[model samples]
Target: MDQKLPTIKEIAKRLNISVSTVSRALHNHPRIGLRTKMQVQKLAEELHYEPNTLAISFKQKKWFTIGVILPELNEQFFSQAISGIEDVATAQNYTVLIGQSHDSMERERMLVEAFRKHRVDGIVLSMAKNTDDYQHLEVLDKYNIPLVYFDRIPKGGQALSVSSNIRSGAEQAVRYLLEKGHKRIALLKGPDSLIASAQRQEGYTSALKQHGLQLDPDLIKEIDLSPEGTRAALTQLLALPQRPTAILCFNDYVCFDAIQAARQAKIRINKDISFVSFANLPICNFLDVPPLASVEQHPYRQGQLAAEMLLDIVEKRKTITDIKPVILDTELRIF
Candidate 1:
């Protein structure tokens, strides 16, 4: 039979020290002298002793891990956000665990609950489009767990958040189209339930009013942030009595699909119709008909800010009163 591994008790007995003393010395407690700690550590190393993570966690009352919940990870936007999160987390000596909601409310709730069960130090969330009720997030409050929302945030405020100025970005896109000699412009908005979509629509409407362009209710189309939805929305927009000369899309994926639908319908890009999309994805370059313009929401910066906020909360480096919402600015990426 294989020899049983030596326990902390065995080490204490062999060292002629009390079990409590040995445990403190092995953990490098401040109360334990350096000589005793060195002796215990050297003996433990020679004995091939491994500290139990459970015991360590019990003592520290922390897992030193963070949970990141995202709507989708397949998109370049979220991928870049994760990159920023990883950078900050690695530097701070914290581990990051990821969970994807797949834009489903049920999945989002499950992920949040699982993270709570795991007792992560904090959570960074980019809410799903279908997420309506935020009572699940109130669980974090109930548990005294810190949560920082990023990109897409929950409705109703006082929640900590780091995001781009979505309304300003949308307004800029709409204003650009109006300046391009396009009178009848259309908008491809995300689902209405999404806070980001609502904010963007508000900006779009504001821009239209600013330019003396009547808000055409028929030109505003709301669809899911999917290629299929974009295709369907574009089909409907093109079939309208007065087809728009330019369309503002929700994001790069929608723009890709809209371009495809336009081509299939024999509509020329940059001449017959133009488009401006948000989230300047890499795939935009590979598209047969690229967007006329795109918005740079600085997703990487948003990620960095969100991660920094979470770490600050964990380390108690700052108080909630000192914490302010970080709203990064956007720039128009003209094609």
Candidate 2:
């Protein structure tokens, strides 16, 4: 009976050769004789030998697998970023296992533990919206797994991260609104727990200050990223005695809520109020009035860069002697 999936040791025993010799022959090592190489290969094929990656990894301590944790994949930003990550991972012969946190810290923590249990060589992560505390991430240190963050990263951390320059993007957006002669600019800011949101808020204020425009305390409202939250903020802003002439939304999708709010309040968009936000969605261009402008944070390239950094650390090709942020810029659209 054919031995089940012959091993290098088994083939060596059958051929009366050393296991090292059998291994070398199987790999076509330069030291192995061509005839001997052919013989070992033929026997391996006949025996239906298949190398065990998991067993091999036990020795090398590298699974050649990367765990990628995303907030969610429904948005084009995340989908594009994942595509970029896959591009680099596949080329490097590293398998990617994906986990979605659904913007929940608890789920993210569980996913981290699961990835650690699998002994992934490294991890690529984008934090959840409510992830203010990063204690859950410390678990990876115990397993010596390299980690890198893309987009939605934390304000404080030693790990490397790739992200769009949200501050600059928001500054640009605010400036664009100012140039159009809109002084009363309201910010539809995201939750303070999000670093991106904080940066965008910072940029909004910075631009207003730079242009000699006073920052209105009441004009800035925190968006919960929910329809109800958006509606409330919009209603409050519209009800103000001095309603903002331009609204800087947190994201493209939030613009939809802004538009809805304006319609119900009988406020004209672009004519009465303009909207500018981040990650210009595809539908942004197709909207009836479209956004005055939007920030194009290139999520795909952010993912690609994050993967490159993580792989470098995992391979020890480039050691991060000192911790530093790797910031990427938002892509520019024609209009």
Candidate 3:
């Protein structure tokens, strides 16, 4: 029969010291004295003893884990983002806990409270589309849990954040259309409550004004970020008295629906109507007709930066004041 592994109690008995002293020595507690710590560590190594993480965490009142709250994990962009987050967390020897809010404020609030109850060291969050109240986020602040927002950030929050420059991306997309001789451009925007949508709208208007063009409210349509919504919005925009020669969609998914709607309306892409959008999805290449241009937002880098920021706060290596909003640049991939 194989010999059973020696426990901390066995080691204590062998050394004729109390279990508490052995545990403290294993942890390298300064109060335990260097000589005693060295002796206990040496003996524990000889016995092939492994300390339980749960016990150590309980003793130190730390979970050494961070929570990630996202609207949904089904998209490829977020999948890549999660991969980047895992890369940083693994390097830092920390664990990650994930929660999907599915774009619901109630779900998001519940997840935040759950993370608080679990006593996670920090959090990385991408706010839900319908989230208007941030009082639940205050719970994290009250508990001294640092938070780093990424991608879809809150309008006003005490948390640090990392995100792509959406305004620049939107401007680039609009500029590409204008350069292609596309006048009377239409914008299929996301919900008004979303910060990302607001930034994109600002960029669109700024680009138009720079070109000495009057902003036309009729050419802009705000819709939910979904395929059905995109389809309906495109129909409405096309049915206007003066239809736009080109359209800039809120995202790749909206672009897909816009293209489909144009084809259904017997409009030739890049000829009768040009299209540009954010999110350079790989599937765009396989389409029968692709948008004239798309924006690369670097979701992977956003995730990595957000994770690093959270870990820094957790390790006490930096504070929120020391961290600034990290905005990565975007590029217009013109087809």
Candidate 4:
């Protein structure tokens, strides 16, 4: 390979300063000294040091900047989550660097690497839909930077996590439907790649078992989330010999599609079929006729807790591995 570009480790070594000092100076952090920042900048310019060229940080010196990477920013759930994260970061006098992965694992990895290269104090991440491998995340460990996962986390508890008690939320919703006299309840399952969705599937089965309802595999459909896909799933569910009286959707977005399809099929929502969804986004409250109920996932709370856990470790006030997970409980919203 061609001569490798200069890195922060080399720059810090040459300047006789900590990597965090170099990172803070480069980013013009307020806590850094004027003379130190100028010196670090001069040395960085001379070395042509780019963020991507760095892979290290200073001991006992934090840059006070956090990186937040999530699946998509446009969605209401992610947007609300970001607000919670920002609230916590602002209170702590820390800057947040946000990146959207758009549910692409490659994009998520790139963002994580970029954050690492910039020497972020820590990262708060909600993994992408296709993030089946997590070898890339090991870089944070090598560098000793902390990370906290929320919402859609990876397998094996690789990092501190904050999320809604998803299984309990699903169980609560299913039990509520049963109380409403819905025996043949259909489920629209999300992709298996998401841990939260998988947990919800298990909760659905557990609720059925708890209530002595026989498991009906045919009543469960994997939702591609496309309009066509939602329509097809609904069509199949309605055509069953004993059509379901209620449907449990993966999320509010899927429930919205189900409502539209149910209406197109001339089924009056409350009269002909009942529905329940997860993730109580604000959009659902604005619906003219909301689903009979939805499980309040508290995405904002998840984000808040995720940021808090990462900051605790980043500031060395707590150890991530030793910290207990912050699991936010859900509420059932009946419309």
Candidate 5:
């Protein structure tokens, strides 16, 4: 049978002192006499006593734990971002509770609810790709839990967020292809629900307009970022009457899928058609035929900044009354 653990009540009863006195002595409160403090410490050691962290946290109403929700943990970009968050959290003596939404709105909502019930001090989230609804996010506000979003933020800049300048990154990618003498450029974008997808589309259209090329509606396609969805989009683009000589993808993962599909269709990568993408993940370097270039979104930096912002709000070091979005500039990384 397991032994019953000692508590402050047991210590106070044995010492013939009040439970409050024992508690204060254990904490080394100034009101506690030196003799009483020593006695409490000695008894605690003798009894193998351990402080009740849950009780202390309840009394203080500060758990020193933060929750992080991401679309997918397996993605290289999100994995690197989580590393940054963990580094910051560990240094500050804070615990991070992680959850993967898997791009499902329902899963994201459930994770948010669970985090709230856990009484986490704050939350850092990368909204799921299909999460167009904001009720789950707004509930955090109702509970007075500060929130900071990274990467896949909501449509508006009304809330605190850390993200890359995706529009500029897309424009740079399209311009790079244009400079390479590829007039017909196609885009394999993410779901329309994602703000990042809209930004990429805007950039693609702007770049074409700048070069006096009309936007080809048929050349742009939206995919669910699934292997099958990406393959279907790639096939449709390839079947166009004037197929695109160059393609811009949502991210490195999408590029990987599209490139594989093209190769299966007997298309030579970088020779028959070049490809560019965002989220310049490290895995791209090891691929047999990697993207021609990628846009470096700096996922790690975004994670660090977002965590810092959320911690600041939680620790009362900064006010959350005003929204301050941190937008990092992206660079085109050539293979």
Candidate 6:
């Protein structure tokens, strides 16, 4: 049989006091004497009394819980970002509910709906790779729920977001490869749906133009970020009449796939085709031959900033109109 749980009424009955008195004493109300407070607390502990969070949430009009959604948890960059988010939530005495969209737009929409139905205080999100619609996110406005996006944010500055400067990072990456005497450099970019991909392309184009070189659309290829997509893109780049001496990949994971595909084709990494990438992930250290360089996007810091911003809005520390988008400058880290 299941054990009966003790309630404030039971504690009051045992102590021969009113339920209101027991409630006030348990809360250590100033009106209650210290002796009475201690007595109630002692008996409550003996009975293994646990306050009903559901009741407390109703009374406070807040759940004290926040939802976090990401594209992939297994990725090192996202895993580190989650750690940063949890740290901030813990300090604020908030519970975190996590979900993975798996880069699916439908999954992302469903998670948002579920979180909204659960009445979470706010949400932090890194949009899925294919998420082009914002109707699901805009629905949060009806419920007055705050949202803060990080890393893979939507394409506008109107939304509260924390992201890295991918355009500058991409420009720096290409410039570094150019200084190394690589004129024929290829770019393995992400799907065009991602704003980051567009930014990277802009940076790549800007760098080439500055060096008196014309932008060659033939040297650029787009990938869906899947290993298969990356390998296929690599194959196309290698088949070009003038093979690229170096490649700048979307990020470290894409670079890893590209490197593997090159090795399989009997192409020597770094010698035949060097590589640079974004997201200076720690996993790069474990690889026998990582990218020649990586752009630091500061995923963990972006997560922290996103969480803090969402909490601020939820707690009424700041209004939506008072907040501005946060964009961190990127750094290129040489291997």
lDDT of 4 by residue, 1-335 (tens): 78888887898899898988888899999999999999999988988777762222354467779999998798899999999999999999788999999888899999999999888888999998778888888778899888889988876654588888888988998999999898999998877778876788888999999999999999999876656888999999999999999999988888999999999999999679999998887887788889988888888888888888888887778776579867788888887
Those runs of model 6 whose alpha carbons end farther than 4 Å from true positions after fitting are 1-3, 12-33
lDDT of each residue in 251-274, candidate 5, tens digit only = 999999999999999999999999
Instruction: Let me know the TM-score candidate 1 reaches against the reference structure.
Output: 0.88
Candidate 4: residue 182 Cα off by (Å)? 0.8
RMSD of each: 2.8, 2.4, 3.3, 7.7, 2.8, 2.0
lDDT of 2 at 307: 89
Best by TM-score: 6
**Per-residue lDDT over 1-335 for candidate 6, one digit per residue giving the tens place of the 0 to 100 score:** 99999999999999999999999998889999998899999999999999989998999899999999999999999999999899999999899999999999999999999999999999999999999999999999899889899999888667899999999999999999999999999998899889999999999999999999987888999889999999999999989999999999999999999999999999999999999999999989888899999999998999899989998987889898999999999999999
Candidate 2 per-residue C-alpha lDDT over 154-252 given as tens digits, one digit per residue, 9 for 90 to 100: 887456898889999989999888898999999999899998888999999999999998889999999878878999999999889999999999987
TM-score of each: 0.88, 0.91, 0.88, 0.80, 0.89, 0.93
> What lDDT would candidate 1 get against the real structure?
0.89
lDDT of 3 by residue, 1-335 (tens): 99986889989998899999999998778899888898899999999998777887898767889899998898767777888898999899889999999989999999999998998888899888888888998668789998899988888534598888889998888887887787799998898878889989999999998888999999999988877888888888888888899988888878888888788889898788888898787778888788888899888898999999988878879877898888889999876
TM-score-superior candidate, 1 or 2:
2
Number of colliding residue pairs in each model = 0, 0, 0, 1, 0, 0
TM value for model 5: 0.89
lDDT of 2 at 94: 93
Best by lDDT: 6
lDDT of each: 0.89, 0.87, 0.87, 0.87, 0.93, 0.94
Candidate 6 collision pairs: none
Error of 6 at 40 (Å): 3.4
Model 5 vs truth, CA RMSD: 2.8
Per-residue lDDT of model 1, residues 221-252, tens digit only: 99988888888998888899889999999888
